[model samples]
Target: MTEVFSSNSELVLQRSVDINLSDSGSRHEDIRELYQISETCAFITSNNYKKVALQFPDELLVDCVAVSAALEKETNAKTYILGDTTYGSCCVDEVAAEHVGADCIVHYGRSCLSPSRRLPLMYVFGKRPINVQECAAAFRELYPDQESHVIILYDVTYSHAIDDLQRLLGDTYPNVVFSVLRADHSHGHACEPFKVRTNSDCQDDTFVHKFGRRFTLTNFMMTWNRCSFCSFNPDTSTGRAESININKALMKRYYAIERAKDASVVGILVGTLGVANYLNIIEQLKESIRKVGKKSYMFAMGKINVPKLANFLEIDVYVLVACPENSLLDSGEFYRPVVTPFEMETACNKHREWSGEYITDFQDLLPGGSSHVDFTESDHSTNDDTTDVSLITGALRSSCLRSSPEPTDGSSSSSSVVVRNQTLTMANTNAAASFLSGRSWQGLERKLGEAPVVKAVEGKRGIAIAYEEEGTERKDSACPDHKNLNYRKQSGV
Candidate 1:
């Protein structure tokens, strides 16, 4: 009895090894590396078989084929796969069972469903007919003592099988889980599904609280997969939301600055596809700015294939939302600005509060849209003086220690200027401000502050002075008493 149990266990392990050897890819390489150092078990499919098979060197392939053949010949190893056998590391089953004389073969596919005499003959002589549910249940039963973790891998076509497996393994088995692997697999060929295997102990309380309540009893598991893995993962939905929030905050700050005095309308342009979802939010942001007495504009640009419902009313900005592919095909050129998600996030966070040259390149992709203003040209100007003063003063005010400089000549007409020779000093101040405000300053503040300072020359149009703040010598071109100035002097004030 002990020998029989040992043989069966070795056979199962050998089958697993064969499957791993057959399916090799970048992911499989990682799996192989992981298995080398840990007790890892892989659950692969025919879809991923090609990828997995390519990972093994030619020498290893020969070794695997020979080992597989020997194991099938020596043991009662039953090979059961749930897809077309024409593909997947070819000749493994034939060479193993026939050449080496293996025990059993179980191939399940659409052709096996026929009621013809050949179908029954194949069922009795070659393979067994088992539904996906029955296969999953059998695996569960076979490893009753082992803490088996089952992942139901299926494509969009066999989504029904996923549902069936989920229903079969419900609350009855706490360890069992289901995941829909989204991939296009044609003709029931063996394909590997992208598996997002979350450890059972890693409970997402916030996810459960938010999406769990919305899950229906009939589709609880399916909905849970959609929410946790598909829609709401931080890499996908949450990241997009963060971008919107950052943009809104920046737009609000821009409005507040403009509202202090009338500034020219600055258009907000958002790209399509991934960034288009924030169109409504950007419009709302413009409205919020308008309410605060600021002139603002908005432009959404992307492919025409983008949904038409993304229209916004009462926005001063021109929106050119359309598809890049269409634009390229129509005009014999592909012209679309691709902004990194990180850049979008940074633009949103610092757009409003930090005063510097703000230019989003997505604006240029729109039809009849002008190129984005160069940051080098805009940052060189002294227009950000008031903005800098406000940032500095705000920082001082928060600490309850007024850093506002007294007028050197006691002239209210004179502008107060803050200048730091070293970019690090400005960076430190900006970081300190962000830390104090409990909000990130976006990339604008960091870049602006870290930029090398060009000292104002003598007889220059603007005032030049160096003031000591927080043990650092800061230089500025703005007059010391010009704190109340609405716009920076360089912005054509």
Candidate 2:
């Protein structure tokens, strides 16, 4: 039996491995340079910041203590290390930093580049080695046309090689562009607001400064794929650039929007507590859902997973409000379809048309945001008589609903029943409530006075791990002094 259990079990115990640390001066210098410890110290001393918070993602937590110690020693200012983030690594945990009364935050590792509202932020993009010449050659080969308008964006890790690649690629491709690293800017929120500009050559080619860089809206926009080029083995000849099929991903997102349109209950999943304007977006989403005559439920959770979401059987779809990088959840494994705020907006507004521009950030959905579009609210009274074919289930679905009709006989109360073909039918306007009512298991049932009551009796004592029975003798008895007490009583003392 033990062998069988062991064979069928999936758990595997991993052996611990010891890593040797080098205390060499060169190694220490590299650490300081890579994390920009000197620059951070300068910023702290110049600003006279008393309390500084150092936020690092899970992967770079190994150097959290070292980085904090170096900063404290250099700046002579108290430093707090924020190892675990409440949301994601990209957005600054202003709430956590506020707990420590930190005036400034120095974020490490890859960030979603979302602007912080509370405290000023400094980004330290650790350098990752890359051969610029080789990357340039690869780019040229992939985009053979010298006139191709390409915007090259990269991960923060490979930010060091961007400038070099820009110079190399710029000489060949006139329209080629590169994204500036966020670390190049002092603070995100402190930077200037987004400005709209147009190029002289192409008046239609608009320019918007965002994500710590200026980008031109041209024919082709190249976004950096996390699994794409930049991370390559120096020894392998397979090359650096790995092409990702973006169209397929967009199609899946569009399908999710269609599914959202058919849903009767929309669950708004609050995935971030740190990002700015999250509360505003949540309220807006609730209003939008109400306007569409659909039910909306808000879920406040730490981390999102399949099982956690599957627990809510009532929710037909979920709209995740999170940072741009983490908002687009691939819901292939989830029981219900998970979509972004942008998709939800499109789904709620029947008049809105998708311009093929996928927005991952909830911030953009807010009023005065870049992706915000003005649309007239649909009249639910008129919509009650309208119906549409569901793109998902291929069933006819109601558009919206108005208030229940007044009693035909001018009575205050009315019956929610209709007689059709000599049979009575219940008219349920609330689709979600009706669906829950039809479920076999409608939660725990309190059958009051159904089962007969039994007399109370002494139950087994002790903890669950080792319960004691009435017949079992406890060696360590509580009355160990019983013999002495009996002798004293016999002596009449």
Candidate 3:
């Protein structure tokens, strides 16, 4: 019998491969040139971090052990190869890092720039070669003369391409603006896409802005894909830049939810585990569904694909809770509608209007956000198993609820109780509401400075403040700060 310590952390071997790194021809070249090798080793060596966990995605996992050993030898650091992530590999695996007492995580491949609470992260976005000269040539040729400020946004993997494009375009189009969009590395915050800057140093009055988001381009003179750096015009059957019709793009997102609002059983798909505070957001989602008076079941899977999701035919819609890059999945080819939590909120809540503004970052939807968009319950009621109950009840299912849609089997009775003495679980929206209303506590990772510190207030409900000091003004029942109540402390009130 092999020695396997814990069931949860057991290493499941599919098959074994025996190959020498030095002996292999093309494989040796490929593995030797694993992106940013010198820089990564130097960082580890300089920092003197003894134990490091190297996280690799499936695509880059080919040289996992080889790279890990190399790092170990070069930096004299103990390296742990983390293959299977609990959530999306884009986020840091605090769980895996803590398992091995790793001082830092050397994350390989794509990253969502998700805040890491415990383990400090070092990202190595493996360099993927792109046709930078060709893309720059296409940009100069196809772009309309009217438009000037061109903000080139791309994934970090294509950082090499952006660097090259910036150099080549500077010679001809001196006035045209270009920015290599960098991910916001600020802890506990998602950065904005645009910033109009008027540099006083420059002689011209041209405005510059940075974009870190991706969009599909079509039906215009120019279109560009952020990931592949491929620019195209789908309508004219020619290729160049991206043309985004703001109104149309917004409407398309809105319409997807209209289809989702018609779903009965909504599935909450967990897309990222590596991101800090994912569990908190999932809890918030369940509560939102409860408030809307709908049935919500959560599915936690590593990689989301079509066939894996098709197993749950009962769910009419899927709300993907993932990183900004991976969250908004296309639902056109899927069996049913798949949308983000923000879309899920718009679809289920009656009072929440879709005014074309969309949110990709889940952090914005966090329950206690300062600018959290409040949504009122819908009174609409639906007896149809395929439709969302909240859209039907208008949140009318408070105590005595009624559904309008007839049973699918041609039941003569319109009453929600039964068609022919058949009791449905979803029929009692109130019951489902109560069942889905609680939040489970997963351990949170907050900085020492950021973590909330609780203090016993004499005359009012217990209060917690980020900074705990005796001299600092203490919040009391009469203080203005008292208006903000800690909902966590409330016992069913």
**lDDT scores of the candidates, listed in order:** 0.29, 0.66, 0.59
Residue-wise C-alpha lDDT for candidate 2, range 1-493, written one tens digit per residue: 0112112223335443332232111344478888888888988888889899999876676677888889888887899999777887667788889999998998886676676677887777676555666666666666677876555555555666767777887788877556553232555323321221224332233221111111111102222222223222322312343444656666777899899888889999988877789999888777677666688888987788776787777899999998777787678878889988889989876666776676666777788987786545444554454577888789997756434445666654323345444666766476567778999988877666665566544555544343455455344467543221111121111
What TM-score does prediction 1 earn? 0.20
Residues 426-468 of candidate 3: C-alpha lDDT, one tens digit per residue:
3534333443454353345444555455654433333444323
Clashes of each: 41, 1, 20
TM-score of each: 0.20, 0.71, 0.58
- Ordered from best to worst lDDT, the candidate numbers read 2, 3, 1
Model 1 lDDT tens row, 282-350:
544343333333344444432232122123222222223222211111111112222221122222223
Candidate 1, residue 180: how far the Cα is off, in Å: 11
Model 1, residue 223: what's the lDDT?
23
Q: Give the residue spans of candidate 3 off by over 4 A.
A: 1-34, 84-89, 144-147, 161-164, 171-175, 181-239, 242-252, 306-314, 332-335, 367-371, 376-493
